[model samples]
Target chain A: MKLLKLIFKNSLRHKLRSSLTIIGIAIAIIAFGLLRTVVTVWNSGVDAASANRLITRQAVSFIFPLPASYRAKIASVPGVKEIGAANWFGGVYKDKSNFFAHMAVDDNYFVVYPEFIVPKDEMEEYKKNRNACIIGSQTAKQYNIKLGDQVVLEGDIYPGRWEFNVKGIYTPRDQNTDATQMLFHYEYLNETMLQQSPGRANSVGWYIVQIEDPNNSASVSKQIDALFMNSTAETKTETEKAFTQGFISASGAIITSMNFMSFAIIGIIMLVLANTMIMAARERTREYAVFKTLGFSAKHLTGLILGESLLISFLGGGVGLFLLYPLIEGFERAMPKGFFPYFYVEPITIILAVTATLLVGVLSSVFPIHRALNTKIVDGFRHVG
Target chain B: MADIIQVNNLSKSYWRNSLEIPVLSELSLNVNEGEFLALMGPSGSGKTTLLNIIAGIDRPTNGSVSVSGTDISKLNESALAKWRSSNVGFVFQFYNLIPVLTAFENVELPLLLTKLNKSERKKHVETALNIVGLGDRIYHYPKQLSGGQEQRVAIARAIVTDPLLLVADEPTGDLDKNSADEILTLMERLNKEFNKTIVMVTHDPHAASRASSLLHLDKGVLSTNGQSH
Candidate 1:
């Protein structure tokens, strides 16, 4: 206990150096947490996907559409229960500044994926009205989309502006399923696009499939793709998770680079801590010698130095985590729509940061402790001051 | 006189790559309990080496050193350190008190190695500080005190554990004449009143004069000065 007290006191010998080292550790940990959260949020779509669901999109490009009649064939496939067709309808609200993920989904969207729950009365009203729309709770809050408000969407592909009455607001049943999308009637886009290309009006961006048995999803997906092998829009069927993962796969190299960069950040933290610990240890050479001359063993001296390093680094890590939570939360609230859905430091990230700080503490103390222990008693005496 | 520290065939050497330089060659000595002895020699006479060996801070190349019937030479590095913490207290020439510690904290350092409780350790430190007449200055840091007061605190620290052997290596080397005299008087009183077994190394004849006995060394061999009170 006394040894610990001495170690604590000695660590505070150079307040500026100690504080700076801690701040450095804190900054490193905060950066590590943010990077890990970025990776997590990036993969969140895949992580939160339901196992029983499958998506069939254009084989070569999602920009191409599948014939809308294929949805009826998919719904009749053995073990298949329900199906809905939806298209990515890129739109801006008010102006380009207010952007969000706007999709034209079928009225059967509720039956295709039951995870997206809407109030019974709202769903009935939405089904009764052709121009009714559904917005995610988060999106509704962001744009103040009340149940009666008319939302005007500026379209990029349909060649005409569209308007819909907000009929319902939905919240996610799970964390991975983001409640930030704007879903409306697929007939509205089909009708508008038919005016431009009358033959393509009977097409959709993708088919969402729900099966009776989740374990047979892979077999069913293979069967579905085989059925479309000779069709004009050759379909690629995949689990919802794989489909979401495909979206992120486009930026795989960038995410990999970020992973490498985070490791580099840890390495830099180690170096800075090592430098500070070495400096502190060197400055206390005479003091350590005195300790040795007073009959302190090599192990005792080692403990003293390492204890100081661990204490400083751990304290810094704690401070870094403290700053991270509020900063990320504030940014989460102010985040532009569809940029980062869920930004947070997970439990795993916290554990990783703490473990990294401990490793840095031990590594940083190694050289200084070695230098201190190797000093001869007589040499220590000679340098007395 | 019963010998408290016994050395036999003691020798120490330094190696510079291929060359072996002997500091002390096949020398031996014995000191009885409660004896105040001064070791004096010219530069390079190996007085400091001899003191270091007896204090267990350095190992003899070839020899055995037994203090209070324990063969310190047979103990490993860690065991020897533990033994020395309980057996020896050192007062260095420059008043080598740790600058960051207060007088009381300095005195409490060696006591940390003991199993004594905190209150008991405090009592021992207070008694030791009072012995050096610096009890009131226990809270003063080493830098705040004068040279004499600092040395007195060093003395207090050395004797705080009441070690059987108190080793002084030129304890008054850095002081003025009056301060040196005061330190010498304090040493005399410690010898007469506390009956501490003191072995001091000094080049100052005036300091040596206060010792009950003096041993002179030249060329690493001890020769009795035959001067005693």
Candidate 2:
């Protein structure tokens, strides 16, 4: 215990160097945490997908639409329990400065995905009113829109201002729900489209089909795709998770690059920590010799040095985690809903970071501590500093 | 008095690349129990090397170093270290008190090797500090103390563990006359009162005069320099 106290005091001999090393470690930990969170955020969409549901969209791209008449044909499939259609409304709130996802979805969407918890009475109101809309929890908070309030959105793709009455606020059951989306009656959008361009209103963007047996999702997906293989809008049907995973795969290079950058940060941390430990060891050569002369064994001296290194890593990681916690919370609040439904530091990331920091501490100290232990007591005594 | 330290034809050589330089050649000496012995030699006469070997801080190139009847030369480096901790107290020229520790803590260092609890260690440290006349300055760090005070604290640390031998190399080499006198007086008092066996290496005649016996080293040969005073 006395030796431990001495080791601790010795570490403070060079305050500036110790503090700078700790700060360097903290920066690396924070950067690594942020990168891991970004990767997790990208995968969050797939995690939110429902196992029992499948989505059918244009085979080559999601930009193309299929004939609305295809919905009846898909509903008739044996494994499919229900079907609902939703289209990207491509609208913004007020002006271009305000940005949020606006989707035109049918009343059956609320039933097709029951994971979205909606107030029972509000569901009936949404189905009855043609101009009513359902907003995600975050979107409602952002616009301060209540159930009875009215909101107006400007359309870029369809043109002109669109008005709707807020009918309900939907909360996500888990990480998969998009909280930044604004879902309104598709009939309202189709009626306007029919008045302007009758041909466009006759088509739908995508179909969401829930299955009776979750295990048959893949077979049903194949059946749905075969049904439209010869049609004008060739379809691709897959489980909801596979569709979301496909979207995430589009940014494959970006994720790979971020992972490589994290490794680079770890390397930098090791170099910086090793350098700091070297300087510390150099400064204490004579003191170590004194300890040696006073009866401190080589292992005792090494423990003193390694103890300092471990303390530095433990402290830096703690402070970095403290800073990261609030930043992740604030980010979850500020980011558009549904985008990063769960932007958080998972237990695995925390555990890995802590383990990595400890490894860094041990690795950084090994060279210096070995050199110190190998130094002859006489030579150490002769050292001026 | 019986011999406490025996050096048998000890030799030490330093290596510089392919060259070998002899520092001490076939040196032999003996120190008795409860003796105050001073070692004197010219600048390159290997007085420090001889002291280091006797303290088991360094090994001889040839021959054996028997301290308190144990062959320290035959012990492994780690075993020698443990033996040195229990058997030797080292006082360096510049009063090498750990700069960051307080005077009391410096004295407490050797006691860390002992099986004593904290209270017992503290008691031993306080007693050691009191013996050196620095009981009031126990909490002061090396930088806060004067040259004489620092040496006194070093003396306290050296005697804290009550080792079999106390080896001081130029204990007053860096101090002025008054401080050096105070240091010498403290060493003399420790020798006389505590019955400690002290071997001090010094070039200072005034410092050497305080010892009960003196050995002068010239070109690695030892001869007795009588203590008349």
Candidate 3:
């Protein structure tokens, strides 16, 4: 313990150098943590997907819609318990920059997703009104929306101005669930399309099937896909998790690059720490000689060097993590509501950061410790520094 | 008087580009217990090398150095270090104190190698510092102390472990004339009062005059006849 105290004092001998090195290490760790969090947030959708739910979309592309009649056939599948349908309603709220996810979902959409919590009275009002819409709590708070307000959506795909009455505000029960989506009655859109453009009616972007047992989701998905084989709009059915993962895989290279960047940051930290420790050891050549002359063993001197390195790295990592929490909270507050709703550093991420710092500490000191111990006592005494 | 240090034909050399450069060659010496012996030599006379070998900080290339009856030249590096911790104390010309440590901590350094607990180590460090008349300056760092005070702290550090022999290399070479005389007086007291066997290497005639006996080395050879001044 006294040796550790001496090591600590020696590390602080050059106060500015040690402080700058520690700050550099802390910055690297923060960068690493941010990169990992980006990857985690990107995959959060897939992580939150319900295991018992399956999504059936057009086999060719999600942009292509399937016939709405597939919902009834999908509901007849043996293990399927409930079914819901939704169409991609590409709309602009007030300006192009004010973007939020707006989907046309069937009345049973809320039934299939019980994780979206809504007040009983508001849900009843939504069921009674054909033009009623339900907005997520986060979106509602952003636009300062309330019940009975008219929300006008300028359609981009259907090429018309659609208006609806806001009837409910829903909050997600799960942390990973996106809480910035707006869902409305699909019948309203279908009926309007039937009156204005008959060819676009009776089409849905996807069908959500809730299964009786989560374990049978894979077989049920296969059965549903087989039923739609060779149809006008062939359906591809998969677990919701797989469906979400497919969306994320569209940017697989970006995710891979992010993972690489995280590791690269740690490597950079190791080099910086190694350089600092080497410089310190070199400067203390004479001091090490003094210790040797005072009867300190080579093992004791090596331990002192390694202990100093480890202490610096651990302190830097701790400071980095301490600074990261508030930075992440600020980032969460600054980002668009739905863009990264779950931007949080997980406990596992903290563990990884600490482990990486410790490894960097140990590995960085190895060469310096060897150099210190290999110094001959006679030569050390002659060293001016 | 029983000899505390016995050197038999000790040799030390360095290898530079496959050529052996002899620093100390076939040197023999002995010092009685409680005696203050000074080694005076010109540059390249191997005075420091002989001191290092005698203190167990360096190994002899060919012969043996027995201090307090242990053949230190035959001991391995690790064993030599352990033996030195309990048996030898070293003082250097520039004080060689760790700049970051206070005087008390510096003196406490050698005691850390022993089985002494914290309080025991503190007690020994205080006693050594008080003996050197730097008890009030125990909390001062090396930079905060003057040359004489730093050297006194170094001396306190040397004796804190209560080693059998004290080896000094040019102990007053960097001090002013008055500080050098003060350090010499302190060394004289440590020898006469505490019965420490002193082997000091120096080029200063005044420093050599303070020793009970003096020997001179030239061209890696020690003169047989020593003189007392």
Over B167-216, each residue of candidate 1 has an lDDT whose tens digit, in order, gives 99999999999999999999998888999999999999999999998999
> What value does DockQ give for candidate 1?
0.61
Q: What range of 10 consecutive residues in model 3 chain A has the weakest lDDT sum?
A: A333-342
Q: Who is ahead in lDDT, 1 or 3? A: 3
TM-score of each: 0.93, 0.91, 0.92
Scored by TM-score, the top model is 1
RMSD of 1: 2.6
lDDT of 1 by residue, A218-306 (tens): 89998999888987889999999999988999899988888887778889999998998888877777778668767888988988989
- The lDDT of model 2 is 0.86
Model 2 shows how many backbone clashes? 4
Residue runs of model 1 more than 4 Å from their true location after superposition: A79-81, A111-115, A192-197, A212-217, A330-335, A383-385, B226-229
- How accurate locally is residue B4 in candidate 2, as Cα lDDT from 0 to 100? 96
Instruction: Return the candidate ranking by TM-score, descending.
Output: 1, 3, 2
Q: Give candidate 2's TM-score.
A: 0.91
Instruction: Give DockQ per model, in order.
Output: 0.61, 0.72, 0.77
Q: Which candidate gets the maximum lDDT versus the true structure? A: 3
lDDT (C-alpha, whole model) for all candidates: 0.86, 0.86, 0.89
List the pairs of residues colliding in candidate 3.
Answer: none
